[model samples]
Target: MRWRCVTGGLLVVMGLAVVHAALEHDEPIIGVDLDGNLFINTSSSADGHTRRLLLNGVDVLRELTELRQKCAGNVPRTTTTAPSTVAASTAMPVSYTGTVGCQLESVPSNVTHLFGNVSLSFCPLLTAESLKVFNELVYVSGDLKIELNTNLTNVDGLGSITSVGDSFFINSNDALINVAGVGNITSVGGDVDIRYNEALVNVDGLGSITSVGGYLSIFSNPVLDNVDGLRSITDVGGYLSIRANAALTNVDGLGSITIVRGYLGIYGNDALTNVDGLGNITSVEGTLHICSNSQLDTSTVPESVRSLGTCQVITSENCMTC
Candidate 1:
């Protein structure tokens, strides 16, 4: 033992041999910029309740080596997925392996496209519970093609739920009808295109929010009566159309708005009486047709726009170029 101590002393003095050694790989420590390329060795006891801390460099390396040697092959070294904690009806924490916060480069080759299957029906809508009502369906991967909206989706047939997240996709739903109770949503990251929803009626609830990213069109919502929520929006990057909303009545919230490139078409809103909101509109890039509104009145329109556009009514004598 005295000879062994002498040999250890000589090794320490030489700096070539030590009782412990650093591991092969260095992992990136994640946080808000505090790591200086260093991490101390840390672990909990067998029960995993109490932790033991080891200091810098060689001593840590040695203790870890001893742990590995003592356990032989029991140390877990790798994980195929990101960390995720799920809550279910059981209301207890259940840990499962799944890729969540991984960036584009971190994704595995097995996953080519993220949201693979575009199913029509949202067959089983995910609900919130006591400890974990998901306030966000966020995607931190930094991909523009994908969206992370928890409060973004609105459903209506059965007193429909309009949970607000980011922005939920239409997902190619065809034979769908009626989105009623979905008025609580107040924010949209992108455009809100309420197209191809044939049986949709009275989309009056989406009024709480005040911004949108892209074009805002209310096309083909055949029975939609009023664009009440859209009244506050003052800017649009693309076209702002109320085209083909046959039953739409008022464009009230668009009071302070002005469009640049796209047309302001109110082609077939058969019941629209006043384009009263267009008084402050200073310019238009395309046609501002209030044609075939059958019930429209030119008295509310400014005289400058009277000659630039035509007006129509159900009565032949009060119709066209009014």
Candidate 2:
């Protein structure tokens, strides 16, 4: 067996290895991962482990007896808590990380407490007054990519950006029409990509973005008509692709988005007719891809998004029962 081909060549030159022991003190060291996977650590100061793994002959004692009846219906019923009147010096203050960037008079007049990540496309002699020296940067913590600035037009000179912490990419800027210079940015932990700005029309300075922990793409902006400035978004934890905006008519500023954990693509807008402003989106954990809008009318999709889930309103010949 040649030691099982030298122990599978030391498990392919040493890759997977997760061992944490602690026996005699009450035996419980289950870490078996060899294509079988079976890590168990409910914690006694061992390490984290929620519960998931037992495929291929699953029946681990009848799935631990249905996971102890779903962990006794998720125990924890002994409450008595009341302690949090806010006040941690009124919170806020946690910026400053590192890496600023270059050019625009080679910034760094103490960079106003500069925080991390700000790739202003490495200054290909960026103008618009070199973004008014990043308006004396207020915060960025991470990601604020402004790519391929082909004579970037209106960024309103980075209107003293508020916060970014992660995602805010503006790609292929061919004379950007508006960013209103970070319009008093409210929140954006990640994903807010505005792609191919072919002279963007309206985002009216991002109308003070409300929330977007991830995903909110507006691709190929060809004279974007109206996102109604994202009307104080109500939550978009992920996925909300509005593709190829070619004069998008109205999404009625998303009519106060009512949550979109993921998937909700309205593709190829050619003057979109009605998403009925997403009629207070009830839910869409995934798949609600309304395709190629040619004056959409998938019954004006948004009867709370077809009862909340899987909908592929396809190729618009005016959404003939797609």
Candidate 3:
């Protein structure tokens, strides 16, 4: 009878014949079978048999750990007689509607979702201190447009938002500097447009975003340097455009992206010298445009991207092999 307990990324395996020995009351039995099905035995049946419950494969260990932590202590656990009633009672939705003003007092707290399209533009009074009201915002159900807010320096109050249901635009903000406030956002259901911001330096705050359901345009930010903050993005459902960022030096932050559903455009970036970050990209459904980068070594374009799926390759006016 062999018993193996694995934590973290590895799976825990237990001999099927010795299942009973691993099902002690104090020991929560969790294991994968020969057929690759994950199961957990939390309670024993009246007939002295261990009743196993199948679990979804997603983050199984983390879920199990959380369950154990919640069941700890002197808190009483109640069995639900009607699961539908209990779920309905606990799943009450909280939402906010309409455009949000620059004033912190105009926004409500503890709201899980914002319903209508929200725009914070041309508000001279908007600053980091007045944006604290957005700390409780978890999701935006519509487009979030923040543009031309001269007084807004940082996006500190938007740290709590994890997802956006539609497009996200941040453009032409003269005084904007740090964008690390939006670091928690993991997904954008539509386009993510960040351009024309003069004071913005780096996009490190957008590191958590994994996917973009639509186009991702990052262009014309004159002082913007490295795009290291976009390292976590894996796929773009539409076009991926990075153009005219005069101060950008490398595309190293875009190393993780594997697919671009639309055109992959990298042009007019005066200071760009390295495109090695685009080495991992496996597919570009549209045209692959790489041109007008004076310092870039065109020969450095990875061989893996040379023959991407049904795309026309356009490379010209770079330093070499153009």
Candidate 4:
């Protein structure tokens, strides 16, 4: 198979005749960049003519291998497509695909928009100062996940980001106090999950997010006292779950949510006394689960939502009606 070199160390394979054979081998042809990031050229059966350059570590390679096996015989061949022209100027915003691990020292300072997913997980050295490089990033074309960062106190460094094209996940950060840094983000094209942050007190930073195309889950954050920051979210395309947040007293911030396309679950939040914030929700397409919240006043649940769509309404376990 003939190979064409593209910018950013990507190599596009021309022939699809040997694509399955190359994937079947124990060691597929892969490129390793100076920063130790892995790159692979893989055929996309969906389009059948163009191949995509994927960037990630070993885990992504393994996932690609499994995908190749599943779609082995179905791939169709066509004339090889020419590579897109790359701009030589460094001042231009770099567009990329696939997943990128956030390495503080290696991050490109010129990037304003990243076309793929970004993950900042288990990064012990990632402090507020080091995150300043990302202050200029205005958008992410895919998911942005910040998880398990032990030393990070706030995400104020992400102040310039206006939107995420896919999911936004903030999970398991031991020292994170708030997500005020992402306050400028106006929308998410997919799910928004904020869970398991031990020291998190509020989600005031998310006040600007107006819509989520998928689920919205804020779960298991023990010290989370209020979601008043979520005042702007108007729609959720999937389930909306706020569960196990022991210190959450009210959902006053969710007052703007008008529709949830899937289930609405508010379970196990011990201190959640008021759900008056959910007063504006006009529709929930699935089940309504408000269970195990001992101090919740069942009467506060608006009569407009008592029926909760076509599905069952589960209100149980010491929830008193005022």
- Candidate 4 error regions (>4 Å): 1-98, 318-322
Q: List the candidates' TM-scores in order.
A: 0.44, 0.30, 0.68, 0.68
- Residue 44's lDDT within candidate 2 is 42
Number of clashing pairs per prediction, in order: 13, 0, 0, 0
* Model 1 Cα shift for residue 252 (angstroms): 1.8
Model 1, 1-322: lDDT tens digits are 0111121122122234332322333432222436555453443344555443323333443555564454555444677896567645543322222333312233332322232221123333222221022122212111111122122233432122222223323322233343333344444555556665655565555554455545567776676677765665666645567766777777765675655245566666777777776666666655556565667765666655544322322221222432
Q: Is candidate 2 or candidate 3 better by TM-score?
A: 3
Candidate no. 1 TM-score = 0.44
Q: What would the per-residue lDDT of candidate 3 be over residues 10-80, giving only the tens digit for each residue? A: 23443343333333355556678999997765566556875443333233345556555544543556887
Q: Per-residue lDDT for 190-303 in model 4, tens only? A: 999999999999999999999999999999999999998889999999999999999999889989999999988888999988788878889999888777888887777877
Misplaced by over 4 Å in model 2 are 1-129, 132-139, 142-188, 199-212, 223-236, 246-260, 269-284, 293-309, 319-322
Q: Which stretches of candidate 1 lie over 4 Å from their true place?
A: 1-135, 138-190, 304-322
lDDT of 1: 0.45
Q: Between 2 and 4, whose TM-score is larger?
A: 4
lDDT assessment of candidate 4: 0.80
Candidate 3 deviation (Cα RMSD): 24.2
